[model samples]
Structures are given as structure tokens and as C-alpha cells.
Target: MDSAVSDAAVGVPPLAEPDEAPQPWQTDRTRAPVATKIVVAGGFGVGKTTLVTAVSEITPLQTEALMTEASEGTDDLTDTPDKTTTTVAMDYGRITLDDDLVLYVFGTPGQQRFWFMWDDLVRGAIGAVVLADTRRLKDCFPALDYFESCGLPYIVAVNHFEGSEQFDPEDVREALSIPAHIPVMIMDARRRISAIETLLALVAHALEETPEE
Candidate 1:
């Protein structure tokens, strides 16, 4: 991830198009809005940390805690039995694009109870990137439902993990019951360019929903 960004900064080959600002409806500063918030969302262990840490301008504050065996029966530890640590509170960071443009990113905790906190986290958030792991595609349903119920625009980025079968975006959307308008993409969160592309898609999708004056 670091390599990708550093290379891009130095004018090395870039996989995506040259970085450009999102289409601006207005260019005035006094009437311009402040920074936007973007929530990085996904099922447990779907690479939220990796994506955030990769692109964040500052050191990320991760609230990860070592998981105890006592949580076995209580928490859903079905496929991820070896998972020892979990983020208890949240992960946060800021990304500054220019003097006036800043983006705040917040990563939600993994447990089901944390769902209650999402309402606050998503307030005024421009959009969310729903990370999906093909191995546990069903696990992302709760996040999807939450965003859909709130009418929060979002894009789903299918995370690629080792030994996971690659599925077409259409098939995955069919299985997840996602609307066609929502952007569905494939990405490796560990790569900076890949993660940035996901955010680009999210911002583009969100801007499209804004009623143009």
C-alpha cells in the first residue's frame, strides 16, 4: 500500500486514472461545505483496518483488544475461530486532499451490539464502503441492511482473500440482493491504489445522488 502511494506521488505508473477532484457543483469557498465523513464498513475481519491504514494520512487509532476464549459461545466465532483480537471501540483517522478538503474516516467495531452506534457514526456521512469477503458473503447482510434502511448511499467492494473464489459482480449482487444502481467492485484492501479506487467509486456514487441545483 505504501509503495503504491509513494510511487504515485513520485509520478510512477498508476493503475487507476490520474487523481482528480470529484466534480464540483460550486467552486465558491464561503458557501462551500466543510469536510465530509466516510465510514469504512464491512463484516468482521473483512480488511477494514488494512484499507484504512493503507490510505489514511495519519496514524490510525485502532481499538483492538485480544479476544478471550470465554467469548466463544457468546460471540459468533464460527469461521474465524483463530481470531484472537477484535476492535472494541473503533478506528479513526483523517485524510487531507488539499487546503480546504478533508475527509474523516471511521471504522466500526465488529460485534453486533456496535450496530447501535452506527446511527451516530453515519450522520452526515457522504457514503460508506461495504467490504465483502466471498467466504462469508452473508456476514455483510447486516451492514447492507443498515445502510439501505437509512437510505445511506454506498458501494460494495468485494475483498479478495487467499483461496477465495472470484465471483462476477452480477452474481454477487444477486446473492446479496443489492440494487443495480449501487457500484459493486473487486479489490484487495492491502493495496493502496485498490482501496483508493473503492473510495473514488463511493464518492462518485454519492455525488450522483445529490440533487443538483
Candidate 2:
């Protein structure tokens, strides 16, 4: 019998393996619930789907409806009011940090009309990422209000879209009425690394909020 065939017959070993070990790129890092749940909240046209999908491991789930004049009355047409459709359901995705730790992200509807689902979506989240578009910046208030009322820890990320003017982080914080304690960061969701950095800030905020050292 051939040497390779003999090894395979005994199931002892393979002729050779690749230099790198076979492993999932995204792994569960923490055992138990080390997998934290986080919500991605924002106003319509703020790029919520882009942020989550930018770093999501599995294919992201999105419920986007095409924009039409019917929604003109329902939605608005401003610099961003041109956004027609809205996410009727949440956009869902998951990422694994290691063998035991995983992070689940749910992108909430960006429209104030969907505020009804806020409580249901944020029930067990350790924190939230509120994406904002500076063009029609006021669009983010409803989401901020929802987070404030729910008492859930959260961070705001400026979804810097093309042609949008830059603003100081402090000004955004004040405009949004974000208390000094919360961390407000900036990110361009279309970029994965930027989204990851934004997430790191959120995790840091969550850790800081944990009781007594």
C-alpha cells in the first residue's frame, strides 16, 4: 500500500496541511453570555445598515423598502429628506470575537414612527450606537430621546456621509444633549475599521458603567 494511503486508512494523519491552522475568522471569545447585545439606533437615512454590515461576520439582515412619493407625507425631503423607504423591521447581524465571545447587533428603524419597537428591541442591550447624519442633524433627536428614556448606556457616532460638513464632537454632544459622562464618538460606517473603532468606544463605555472596581 502507498505511504499516503496507509496513513489515511489508519486515520493517523494527512500527508500535509496548510501553514495556517484552520479556524473561523470570527470566533466566540467568552464562554457564557460574554456575547453582549447591542442596538444600533438612528434616524432615517443615517446609514445604520452600513455600520452593522460593515463589520458583520454573517450576511446581515435588512428590511429596506424602496422610497416612493407615498412616503413623502410620511417622511420628508430635505438634504436627506429625499430618503424614501425605511426599515420596517430591524436589521440583524452577529460577529464572533473569539471562541467564547460573540456580539449581536440589531439595527433599529431610523424613523420616529417606529419608536413603538424601541422597548422591545433594547430590552437586553448592554449599550447602543446612535448613528447621526449632520446634514439634517435634528433627525437624530428622537433616537437620543428614546435611549435617554430607556436608561440604556449608548454612544453617538456621526455617520459622515459624502458632501456632509464636518462638526466638532463637542458641538454634536451639546446639540444632542448628550451628558458629559457618555462617550460620543465619530465614525464613517462605510469603513469597517472605523466601525470597529466606534464599537470599541461603546464597549469601553459599557465597562466604565459597570459597578465598583
Candidate 3:
């Protein structure tokens, strides 16, 4: 056998590995997509995760944990009987609106106990989506109050659920006592088109509220 062949037979490894190109998010600042952060907030079992999963182009990160007896009194499962898990920390996902614009979505946990994380999640966020369920409209009050107190621009998205009563946007606004200038509309979080439209509405509202430089 030749000396080179003998060396190969002795399990010698290759001298080099091919270089891999950087992903769009990891490229230079000049070429990288401009990132815009947004928060998706709502009460428990209001479909925040579903919206993020449906619209994100990349795989989403979820910190869900199976429901156990530990949450017997703390987490309410009455409206979400079929729900087997809950978001413990937060949910993260990303969507690219265009080659130059990317949106980073952060979903806050619904339970009040987890609300401490909201401050951190909304640090650099341009705006927020307060998803509401007509069946339990009161559940979203905390999210609304927090955003308002923080002076963060946000739009209310009433997620459509089967068998749930449908209300006109004006009616919803009246019920929630949302300001007239704040956008309030219906959205089906599980549908991609609906989710995208909801997000766009929020972005538009945020832009309108921003002071011109």
C-alpha cells in the first residue's frame, strides 16, 4: 500500500473544513436586515403563541411547560380546558417583511405571576399587540393597563374563536374602553393572513404616533 493510503487507513482526519456563509441575521450591519421588535401580549390561553407560530418565517422559541397540579389555583384552566401546556417564560419568533426589514416578536406569559418579564421583553419593542378573546375580554385588561401606563403604543386584536360572539370594532372599543385613536379589530390568530394584517395594523398605528424627526 502507498504511504498516503497507509496514513488514510490509520484514521488520519482531513486537514480543513469548508467555510459556511453567514445567515442573513448574522451578516454585516450594512447587509443585515433592519430588525424591529414587537411584543404579543394577552391573557392566558388567548392564542399569543399561535399567532407567532403562524406568521414567523423562522422556527419559533417557546418556553412551554405541561400543566400539572402545581398550577391548580394559580393558572386558570376553566376557559382553556383542552390546553395541556402553558408558557412559563416567553415565546420568541421572527418574520421578514422584506429584504431590508425584519420583525422580532416576543410573546409574554399570560399569568400575572409572569408579568415581571414583560418589562424586559418590551425594552426595545416599537409596539405591542394586545390579543383579546371576546369570550373573556376582561382577561386582557392587565395587558392594556400595562401598555398604557408605560406609554407604549399598542393596538387591540380581538382574536376570533369558534362559537364566540362577534362584535363590531366600535362595540369592542366601547366595551374595552379603548381610546378612539387606538386601533381595535378582529383577527384570527391561527391564520397567517389574519395575523399578518393584525401586525401591519399595529405597525401603521405605531408609525402614526411617532413624532417626525
Winner by lDDT: 3
TM-score of 1: 0.82
TM-score per candidate = 0.82, 0.81, 0.86
In candidate 1, how many Å is residue 197 off?
A: 0.8
lDDT (10s digit) by residue, model 3, range 1-213: 453364356443212223634346566566867889999999999999999987776678999999999999888877788999999999998776655577889999999999999999999999999999998999999999999999999999999888888998899999999999999999889776678778889999999999999
lDDT of 2 by residue, 1-213 (tens): 464464345442231233534234323343354678889998887888888887676678988888776676667656665565668879887765554466789999877678888889888899999898878778888888877887788899998877878888898988878899988777789766677677778888988887886
**Off by more than 4 A, model 2:** 1-33, 81-84
The sequence of per-residue lDDT tens digits that candidate 1 reaches over residues 42-154 is 78888888788876766788988888876777667666666778877678866655445666788887568677788887888999999998888988899999898888899
Q: In candidate 1, where is summed lDDT lowest over 10 consecutive residues?
A: 16-25
Clashes of each: 0, 12, 0
Clashes of 3: 0
lDDT-sorted candidate list, best first: 3, 1, 2
> Which 10-residue span in candidate 2 carries the lowest summed lDDT?
11-20
